[model samples]
Target: MSQPQAAVGAAVPRVDARLRVTGRAKYAADNSPDGVVHAVIVDSSVGRGRVTGIDTRAAEGQTGVLKVISHLNAPELPPVEGGFPPGEPLRPFQDDRVRFFGQPVAVVLATTLEVAQHAASLVEVAYDAEPVSTDISVADPADEPETYARGDADGALDSAPVRLDLTYRMARNHHNPIEPAGIVARWDGDRLTVWEKTQDVQGTVATLSGEFGIPPDRVRVISPFVGGGFGSAARAWVHSVIAALAAREVKRPVKLVLTRRQLYFGVGYRPAYEYDLRLGASRQGRLTASAHDIRTENSRYERHSEGVLQPGRMLYSTPNVRQAYRHVPLDVSTPWFMRGPGYSTASYAIESAMDELAHELSLDPLKLRLRNEPADDESSGRPFSTRRLRECYLAGAREFGWHRRNPKPRSTRDGDWLIGMGMAAGVYDTERSEAHASVRLDADGTALVQSSASDMGPGTATSMTQVASDALGLTMRQVTFRLGDSLMPPAPGHHGSRTMASVGSAVQDGCDKLREQAISLAVRDEDSPLYGADAADIVVRGGRLYVKDEPTRGETYQRLLARNNRSHLEAIGSYAGASESEKFSFYAYAATFAEVAVDARLGLVRVRRMVGVYDAARIINPRLADSQAIGAMTGGIGQALLEHTVTDHRDGRIVNANLADYLVPTHADMPDMKAIYIEGEDYEADPIGVKGLGEIVIVGVAPAIANAVFNATGRRIRELPITPEALL
Candidate 1:
């Protein structure tokens, strides 16, 4: 089939937008099977302790309460097999130990949700509390620090003409989606089916089956729609297992929805970080060496780490580089991946330091970055697949009027407010995973595609449908894409910006196979108009198969299939993995510019305008890509000025767990924002040539805002959520 230029790059409307906007999309909590009951979890109040005794008699006696299960009465579950950190996963209600505050201690199942909640409140638990350490500053490192060194960092720092030593802290942040994590589990004659809110339906099936010691085929997971993920729902949390066990014990389907307060504990959050950095540079602002000492928060049971040191190791051309990453186990739950994950956190520190270096050398920040750009990945000694970051900078500078701003701090003032512009460079590793999809072409000249991927607000269904439509030589209306079910073709988790490159590739592969099948049938049919035409000369367009040189000699797919007595043609699409020749480093790059106004007297910082120029290869839909950029910039504004998850060290409890206390960016806080994509494609990245966009957009944003604040006020705050108090 000849590739069409229209659908792939066009700004097509989301195919599922109507279903989502009209409230017709079915989320996990919307699924309710016959004879369903509600389950409520009872959490411990202590930060660190052991359940000494439990009194569940009152809860069991409550009306409609079917069972009150605690560690004392809960059935034993098989050990969880595999996880990211390579540790035994946490099992609910299987042990007396309480590793953190708000840990689920018991569950109450009843005929109604209200009764279950009321009965859960009646269940009493006794605990022997221990001194809790939630403070990163006071906690001891759980193990030896992980270290990486490239050259003689100490010698280079000592001999450099200029030096800087800085310490930066980022507060923990939570993923508070409007739709809370929920699960509805049912078991029929040893077969388990769960409707759970998750990014990976297939992974959930495997996890639940492993926990229950059942074959994978016996477990099915369905999550047709998800409200939002942002990485919190990437894995099946402990509550999912609790819900399934409760349903089995009750012998009926059970529904469990986490309350707002419970969400703060049940789902994962971005971990707090303390980064100590030392940089040595030449008088021209070229970096000579960088030494990073990083400390992060994690639970005592499982060590959680991200790619925190990656930015320092490979972002620039430093010859002497060293890194030490340590996890300080605290009385808190294990942190999971959030949007941008490690790269965003690391970018704030590195990019802010870069801005400082620019100031010290009296150089434009963009020019200083350009001077130090690496020709290859210094850490791995590999050439880049494609790096258009310089182009992004040029485009952004031209469009954003970057040259008009005065480089001197506190130079431009209007009344009580100071105006300044700042920019930062952003990078994220291009990631791809193996995935599979199934495509079918019906005699009616329509196509159906299926994959067990997710659409967590990135327009996965719409983009994939466009790809399928173009590849199958059909109109947008002739294609239907289905996802979020374990029974469909297998796909990796939809986090890490891999859904497009992985699942989309599979969809393309499937459509290509199906198109080939149709072409074979058409060429072999003696009654076809172009019966003697070579298969290579055939081109399918608008459901019509014709010889490339003779457009008029063609027949509709419907007629061809009907004459052949075929109902439909089907094929399985597969992406094996990244190519073996991928010796080149792959990443998506961006240049983020921010204009901010600061009130010196009131210590108020407000972003006035923002522009993001990105070099993410091959944007499937410009409209959806812009949405991703704008949303990420908004999140960066929050991270720089508002968002913080406060913990009370005395009890290890989250102080501002609710929306009212925790702040995010709202309409008033949104600045005049624009996003521009650099024109390009990286076929080495994937068949679709997309390096991914969701995470990279947010990577350098916080630092850009921070640098702008410094340029306005002449004061730098190394801590995140740079509050007015910090400026004062």
Candidate 2:
């Protein structure tokens, strides 16, 4: 914004990229403390049953076996209260009930990794087998679905000349990163220290402190280096607690890393959804009414529901609308947030139904979407803080050759493939949270900044540093930034794409205050050349303050401090969300274009190219933001074409628990992906004039790909992960 300065809008490489790429960065598993004991978690065999007996005699007799802990022999712990932003506390080994498969039943401690592995197999468990009802054939969610309505949808649909009624099913997906979940916990009397793999270090500390009944200060969670989280590490799952408790029970430091298979059950996932959508529109593509019936799965112990009805109520300008969201409480593990959890699943249904409407009315898909863009967020009746969805649609269409696309299915072909192009609108809520930061300026003309925000491999630390540099009039090398420790300045947990908006603003705040502190000291001192100058008229460039009309009248901050006998100066700044979000409207929007080629004989669908255009407030780092968007598109392709977490309903066990059985996008499947960010700031959203982009990037991806498939083939698949069998 300021002539491409180091602040706000810049393409700066990550501050820690060298450490990460040089193999010098230390992840949690890389930490090896003296006298560290190895640990292994024994999981439940039966999906729904109670452990009647645990054979630990063999494990205890083996060499180097420190301890074997089960609910029968484990220590009494605090209760768990579950939900986000410090959900219910976690009590790992407090009970004997087996709620789902892969629930940790026992933890074995040994002197060596091999010894722990051998001893874990020796400690056996026998359970009373119960019926496993993990079937997805017919999702029978719980009673009393949450319902919302604004107008009479039934009456509008009855009077409309065009209508549609269709159902969509979404497959379960997992966030499998290269690094598995691990925790190294050490107990020093009543205090505990844990080097964990997590997204929210402060949240983990709070959960562990509450679970163990220890004071918050007694627990320290350090996660400087994380491979990748998606949403798996948002909270401290049961594995972390089990490892910490094992350390307390054994009187030694213990390290526990969940096996890849255990990851499917230990943490959370994107739950399966079954949605029935009904729509009414005019013959000219004007939407009149809509109805949505959504059902998603949750564990019996916890009542969780993804907000799949949000899109239907707001995306288009539909006057008559009714929606109900129901949760099916199955005997499965609790599901948590995944990338674009609600928006992705909901858009698939809404956009697919729109595609159906386009076919019936003989209208272009892009034209149909444009005809329905709401003048405002209809549900809230508030003007958007900013909306560039129209621009995205225009730009993406031009770049992807949308004008050349044939509306007729199976009309375009090249060699052994049928080529087609499709586009869909994507939307997501922006992030807003209370965040704080501290900045300290040393007399040597260098600056140090600290915050509680985290970098979940999206280059948050680097971006924050760049913001601090320009605000303080310092180079990137002159500023040192730190994160991922609870001891740093207090900040909200990083999620919802709010990190940059909230934390980056906080860093800017701190730097501004620090710079002001130096300027105030200089203006008040007669020894300084800028003595008695008005603070408003003084502008500091690279640590040297000068007057508005006279450049030679001011002196460097180093001289003012040296004459004042000061060693350093510091300031703490805080950023909070404004009340305007409630008074006005706020949402980030994107439009995606996808081109695909499907083999007519073998049903092999390969994407040729894809592009995403976003109106996500202001981008902090262009390069990193571009990468985030492209990676999100690639992930969406996986969700549309390959990703599925299969469960063996016969026994209520996840069958495709490992990478081999499950599928994700590899380099071979990657297409030529591109991203374009509209430049500007939404001042009503935050002080930093930015909105969130991470979650929205993937929201409309699956639908975009599905629409392209429909354009390529005459058939329209209703379900997700559209397999080759369906096409054949």
Candidate 3:
């Protein structure tokens, strides 16, 4: 009989889809321990101040209010060992100083969530306010910038035949996931267990252990499901610490969930950016030199930085390049990664500048990008492992019907709507980290795999199951994948799109080892049908081992294991990660196209359709890949037209903290979207040959829409969101 089809390349439905749709999957806040109590935090009103007094008498008098804890009565936490970025992480109730407007000052515990919320409001606080610097435009950047220079950018810009100078501003964005940040902490003696909504369970365990000064093994983090993270849940925020601390103090399980408004200040956000770009190119669209000066916001106490300067340095073949990235301190919470992160932000400026150059030179936007494609990574001076960007562009152009577009601005029009088409290129680094997985093949001919990696809605379990099934020569139904428990084999946090390349490789290794062990036992057994067969010549399909040349001589794994009297075969698989001395520059590439309709009179812009073609090596599951690309495109729509976190600088307050005021893309706003992936693999990049698909999908989306808007209305709106006021 012919061998069964492999499960790796098939479009399999998510393994947990049934559980998710039926409300059987337990989220972080879904768990309520036997004696769980509720805790609510009281936020500071002043932007910058010292707590003069905190009156908890009224809160203490309320019925069901167990205690109101603040700096005065709260126990001191041990010094944390290591924190994110490079500064002091916010410690809940550690001192009287209020660094930001919504800094948590006190927590109230009660028998019910309603009582805790009511009592938290009754707790009074007085502060000595100080003048705060909350504005990024007016604030001074760091005196010494992080700078990179290869050739004389200034001299080259002066001598180039064509040049363009542009400045763009982007609004700060929040990760408003459907599930708010929450934690349920229960301590028994010196050991602790927490059910948290987080992207990294092991990262949470480490943070909690460091704060409580306990061994790492003493803290257990269980997170089976995460509604959505988008980088907000990557780290253990201050709310998590507060919940654990309260549970320890009260000697009972404590559950703390941030309100929708509190999410604005409680968790991390994408920092706003002010980017000034200067480009010098030949008249024929050959890039010669570029200079980028970027300024972004961070907290006064801690500094947060990202890869905003990377794309500026190496996206195209520029001989001379200069970059200076600086952080402006503000009296606000420190920013963190959101979706595409720095690469997406930089692409907005670089890709927009390229489009502007194309308009100036009277060339097709796609052709202009093709003219400047780099042979190798200029920044690192290394050849790319697999750069299919040219293929991506060609595929996108054909699928998007680039030839039908009218190059002239304001040239295509329907009834009261000016139609325009535009496109941009995007790039993101292919990052990998060390990971491990545990695999076991039971005597009953089934397999179980476990890892500590998280699945923040990317269908990680499904993808891993596919890999394991293919490697073990078993049907998809015979393999099961489990994740999100700290006790499992170690793996990196589920961010940066590294889960598939790193964790998937580990699973493949474990399954392959276990299969080889079974083959060895079968080849050596006297009673087995393939007893004398060469192990190297043996292949397995549907749990049956047979010789490659002679298919009839085979034995079922069930019979082979029973003859050996073995209960199970197990192995620990590991991936040492990317090479320290890397030979090639690795990155994922995308070409995004957009068609938009602009109403000049009403200053409104609506996207009609979008097409994105990507070079994310070797898709494991087409269904999951399409979901990631489409979801990211939707986020791109929000970034381009709706999402913005408004702040009132006068008091450092987020003016539009709730969803009603802060806008996002509803189902009504989404238009036709299509995502296409180039087929093939890049073995040089990783063992699994996947370059990561999540972040690159959103990288160039905003610029494509912006370019389309310009084409429709002949207006160069440098700022984001393409608001009506700007168009008018």
Candidate 4:
């Protein structure tokens, strides 16, 4: 808590904000390797089929057409592999069998992007088509769902004085980042180097090495900057491999980017959900029992399901609970993680149901939630490293003017709009994994810190640099922090908001060790100031070592190193020992508040304002954290009101594959937004004690807006993107 420490609970500006604002940052697509040739993929026209043959004569004959690589002439790759046993591995053009619609069948490399695109249309494909199952409702359900029970729910629900049963459905959504998913690959002899848009560079390298039967070291992956991932780039997809294959076949570097339409199938998305909830409560609105039945879509070749029921299992202190979660298998592309994935979906149902209970019991929603707040994690019975959900509500309500709520449907009206306010609680796990960093001190006294962590528009590089500077007693300008190449020290993948807790710890460790080395050298030198001071009593400031109680008596690191005739000092700091299992029970909590205006005639709903109060522990950079929290809240608005993926089902294909057809929120759609950060520490989680804020910022957003809609117009609509037709 000291002023000069630069420790936890301070709002610091991001060190790299200027680079991004000045347009100096570089993303994956920005890398233009010399001799790079553009490549375009050709996808299957049918939904499902067996490719009888491929005719590439016309495409191969075009000018600047290096070659058309398909199953016929494509070099053999190791069979696709999956870490999860039940899921199918994505095999790009490995055989004649086509699993789903728009699966890539071939790649055409050309001198220009337009030329390759034109050539891709010329290639001909013939297939024996088969009927496909795209709709989960029409498909047969799994015989038995994964069931977890604590107490009898049927009897409790029947006997309780208050009860509610409801179902919520959500549509598939795409991760449409500003920069399209693409890759640039170059082949040097048998080794391949790729500049790709990905969340996990190491995961990409390992997968590519396995696919090509090459050593992992031979494959290098770089993704320094990302436009916005939203979990789409969590793992390597087929497009990266397609580019590498094209480069190998053409004997030239290839730059392949998925077309907007191709992205629908090239990557994965959040699977659709249908959730049924049954709840029982006491007359005083203290909860009793709950039962949940949920089903999500997956591919016949793979089993995919989110931990969607997790929030319900622990968020509230319900007594008797029974839950059944099942995945309905269909012939469709497997789903991957999305922003707030499981937490967002589950919160919408549970929180909305809580709102309805409050109304039925004639009690305020905030009071109802406070009544059921658990002292510890109910599911695990572990004391929380920190639980601020109640604090988030109390503080948020005061800041958001919760007392001013009209508390009556359609009671507060402004001309043609019905105005109302609502709020909901949010939660997400504070995940951690093994990470490592290397710190090097040069003769000139400048320090270099390297890690494999990436900045996906979240200012990761900037925050990590701040960590190194503070720990090593160096000014921000003297420490250079580098990230994004697999060659750097290891780091956890940027997901689940774990980057800071995992990678920041690594940085702190590396810098602390490096600082210790400097101190040791300074103490041993007879020419250094305070030569006989105890090592533990020496503190560093501005790259200088001094006795703890005095400021004037100090020796610069450069002076000590030069007097000792040493060139440079180095150390490897690893926080890989920090894992989720041992450290602590960590999670970030948020309270989302929303105010909306509804049109009685048009059924148009416009969110007028939103406030998100978060308890994410120590914030490294207030400026960047504010932007992230607001951006996530804006994105959550889209999830609650505007975004939804459409499917053609007839041919088992996504209908709105492009951005234009698949609507996302633009600047005009955003409302007045505010983000509040709570200052605290949980040293048990990591050295930095910083819990994740990225995912939790949007966790409870949808439910808040949905509850607001009900308040504005006495209507309880459970499904997502609560459309005009439903209210009208």
Candidate 5:
């Protein structure tokens, strides 16, 4: 008999690929509850102000208009509980104050979307406008900045033989997913149900329950599909709350979908940053000390913070390091995590500075990095669970043809284009959180597994099915996995790249337990074949239980259950997550290499190719991993050369609110891209031996492209989106 193939390491197609291609998949906006009415928000014209008057008589008189609700007539909601970032969260239609541009001031509900939209426009709102501070450079920073220090950075910089001081400016970026944010909400008496475009369904439920002054069990959020959520959908924004409120007031289901224009301010964005870096290294390119001062934009109401200081403290072996991160309040909506979040922003500065030092020392950029590889995490003083960054560098360099590149800028020219090669290292935390999964094996020789985790375009369902198939020793076709319902066993939110490490592990545990239960029953049964055999020696494959050394002595699960008059086996698997006092530092590592061509006359920078080697431990699905890597690389290319969110400081309005004006990389802009994963396992990081992959792929991409531009032009552009004017 042929041995059954394991599904875990195989390149399996996504289980939902057919559903997506056939248009059977249902996203948040696709849900249409019975008797659903449409709602359109009337946004504020002023950036900062208080609403003095609202004339809704014209909107209320419109045909099919059910009601026009604003802060003037809206009921008071319960105070929000446990707001994030240690400040007040924006509540829609709850107050008269307009905190930022496009703040929702009124909601128009009608029988159809067109009527609601038209009515929303008819509503007139008068604001007492106030001066706005939207530019980070002109705004004052927080009174106290978050500070960290390991040694005397000032003393080291003063004594070092070589030093470089650089300042970088990064424009704000929006998520701009293919599908805009939407919600379908219904209130059945005291219980509420909602279908929302969110990365965390349970988190949305909690937020709604708190605001409505209802019990947790009274709220249910269902979101089976997400078009694409970089990080904007991780939390329940105020729009979701507004939808629910409208449903209750109108006594019918309400559907609210943000238009393309509304998405600019309706959802969160990646805030702009001004990073100032000073590094001191030896003449031979060995690091001595570094200091980083970072200021990023935030809203005056909510103080947003992230892991911006982590990379500066631990990415290298620098002994003396000082870091200060401050938030500059602006008249805008709060910013949230976008792609790699803080690590990507910091890497651009740190890695670019490293490349500059390499050039100053007349050394290979790759070699200079190799010289400062850390044995342990310098920030936490903990050994690494698996730091294969050196291997990544060596493998990436070999694959990307690093040895053939000339050191001097502008030396290699391809006719009108100046060709150059550059590389940078990337890292992100191997974050894990408590999770649970429920598994049930039926007598029909099939299994079902479930969790509350979300997919968010990483193929979570497919990967979890693969893990379950391997753990249960069943064929991939016989196992089914389901997610995105609050009723399923609890799991962590599908952000931070923790879905695989946390939810996948729980699925494996659940499947293993069910398989073991069946084995125990078969061994103890007198009527079963191989009775009294050692349970330890028993293994299940292709839904058949057999002795490991004697494959012929086996029985099908279907027959065994039939003979024993059994129905099914079930188990709930759980993982308690990482310990706070763990001894090892856990992170996913990558070495990204890029090749670019610069048109000096037009000041254009075009990427020719990119290669990324990652050490993310075990990969459940290579196909899915490659998709993540390539997509992130594309986004990075946009960040390096095109994408930017322009703000009008005059009134705190986003200048380029639509895609036509705000640029992203097109198909023509993308070039050859490759992703290679190192073969290994990191058991210390999680039970599945898998570190996170999604965020790390994008961490160092911007820096790699930026470094390549410098190599081609011999001009250091410290700002992001190395624009044509900047290159010229």
Candidate 6:
């Protein structure tokens, strides 16, 4: 028997790589609409104030200047609506109130970008300044802390034999993709077309339509390529709206691209966090209770928060657990979801506490986690769809040589540097939102599939093509998958690692239906070679429909379609979402191990190598999956040792707004990194059996490095970025 030709699990290259490398793939800023003019924004100088008056006389006098738009002259827009819940949206130029520093107060339109930029700088504004508080520590809580409790946490903590209380702080981080946030908006009569850099094309359409009071069908968003998002490009910001408004007023296309400095305020960033964790465990390393008090910073207007406490509630088996998440509204711009969101931040505190407990109990860190592994989700009391965290630990430990490590801090030395190894477990919820895909099989034996999903560096198009190619029994070259257009089938934005499980399933569903249509045609036709074959027994392979038991009785798709007079067969595939059966907990798990060399005298920490083993169910394109894991691990390294967004608390200004000051991992910083995936599939999680991989890879990375630093040096640092000053 011949096995089916499979592309789903193959290590296929990205379909769009050629276009990207050749600079042919059009980004948002690359598009040049007819009669396109340039637009540049003027930001407010004061952090918190109300604009008294605006003087645009100098800007208007500049040659090639089209218009200077500000609160004094810009038209009123409909009230902004629809975003992640809990906060009022910020509307552009709606009034004179300046909520934060660098708030967009005006825009300049001109014939060229330089002219617009020069004109924007000339616009002067007057403001009535007010006292501003950007410091997270000084800001009062915006609302009552949200609390969750399961058992008697205080009582359990008091009775526990071993206890540890630790406080950890993480600095704010920004998403600085090489391509800055940009938009090219064009208006034709009442219809609007925008080429935007966004993670969600449909979300942009809905947001723009609501803001403009236009019907949804009249707004079109095209974003086939996104340089990088890391969650910053997930929403439609005020710049996109400003571009559209300017285009409508000027009766021409308007292009606006945020500079590197402007990106700090133009888009949202990951909020800084102060996490206080109190843990209780038995003498034998059994977890008894856990309490987490988390305070995160956000804008004064919007209350932004992510899934921060989920790791505390579900990552381990604790009978008594309590959590309180408080949003401290500061005089700053709104914060948004970043890579790993809440789980990454929480993992640092929870996982570090676990490491401390291991040191206190004299048990191996991995063994301690293994001992407390729950049979089901302790929070929900539901069985897991597929939990292979134990497998990840075993594999990662074996690959990283964890058994050779000395648990005693500062014990192992390599001449001037102290050597240490540490490991931490990671978890991300399996999120599957509703998505739809359209697949069409042409009579010429080629197939096309499309979704409205965005590819923010995770190879969404490549992965979906692999799925469709396998499902439709077509070769890799015969299938092409397209995404990032609002006119295509609707898809949830690519975030929380949900694109593969949601959009991939829809592609599979749509391709399966199309294949069935061809099978029906081949079986029913009397002139076809497959006429006598049963439809159920017929299988399609290499564009040929043949009986499974008898391969010789077959006919080609082109021949079959020609005889049937069919030009093409199309179907719309849809995945409603995960079932509501309430029987299973679905999550992607990883075990991250790091080896670091710390110069105790000089306060220098260098990560020598790192290993990440993931049980992210059903590998689709192993090459792409590996790239995703490695990229995430690199970001994790940055979070642990390099990246920090320094803000000037006095004036609510980001001091390191540019890449030169705001550090990220360069080639010299990346160590010998390895990514490994345990081979398996979780069919219960979704149709394609893919547990998401993007977010899980970054979850435990920071803690692993932090724990390794502790192992290398006798001192333990709870704060993030593990600065040299702290080591000294």
**What clash pairs does model 2 have?**
80-89, 81-88, 81-89, 82-88, 83-87, 83-88, 141-328
Superposed model 1: Cα runs more than 4 Å off: 579-581
**TM, every model:** 0.99, 0.97, 0.99, 0.97, 0.99, 0.99
Candidate 2 per-residue lDDT, tens place, 399-485, comes to 888989899999999998998787888888886888899999888888889987777778888888888888887778888999878
- Per-residue CA lDDT of model 5 for 1-728, tens digit only, reads 12244998888999999999899999987888889999999999989989999999999999999998899889899887576667998987888999999999999999999999999999999989999999999889989999999999999999999999989889899898998999999999999999889899788888999889999899988988898989989999989999999999999999999988888898898889999999999998889999999999999999888898999988899999999999998899999999999999999999999999999999999999999999999999999999999999999999999999899998889998988889999999999999999999899999999998898899999999999998888888999999998988988889999999999989978887888888899989998886999998888899999998998998998988899888988999988888989999999999999999999799898999999999999999999999999999999998889889988888888889999999999999998999999999999888789999999999999999999988888888999878999988
Global lDDT scores for all candidate models: 0.91, 0.85, 0.92, 0.84, 0.92, 0.91
Model 3 stretches astray by more than 4 angstroms: 1-5
The C-alpha local distance difference test score for the whole of candidate 6 amounts to 0.91
Residue lDDT tens for model 3, 1-728: 22334998799999999999999999999999999999999999989989999999999999999989899999999887457777899998989999998999999999999999999999999999998888999999878789999899999999999999999999999999999999999999999999999898888998999988999999999998999989999999999999999999999999999999999998889999999999999999999999999999999888888889999888899999999999999999889999989999999999999999999999998889999999999999999999999999999999999999998999999888999898999999898989999999888999899999998899999999999988888998999999999999989999998999999989988887888888899888999998878888888889888898888999888898888898889999999889999999999999999999988589788889999999999999999999999899899988988888888888899999999988988888888999999998988978878988999999999999999998998888999877888888
Name the regions of candidate 2 deviating beyond 4 angstroms: 1-4, 80-90, 578-581
Please provide, for model 1 over 655-725, each residue's C-alpha lDDT reduced to its tens digit, 9 standing for 90 to 100.
Answer: 88899999999999999999999999998888988888999999999999999999988898899999999
Over 4 Å off in model 5, which ranges? 1-5
What lDDT does candidate 5 reach at residue 244?
A: 95
Weakest 10 consecutive residues of candidate 2 by summed lDDT: 82-91
All candidates: CA RMSD (Å): 1.2, 1.8, 1.4, 1.8, 1.4, 1.3
Residue 696, model 5: lDDT of 98
* Better candidate by lDDT, 3 or 6: 3
* Shift of residue 352 alpha carbon in model 5, Å: 0.5
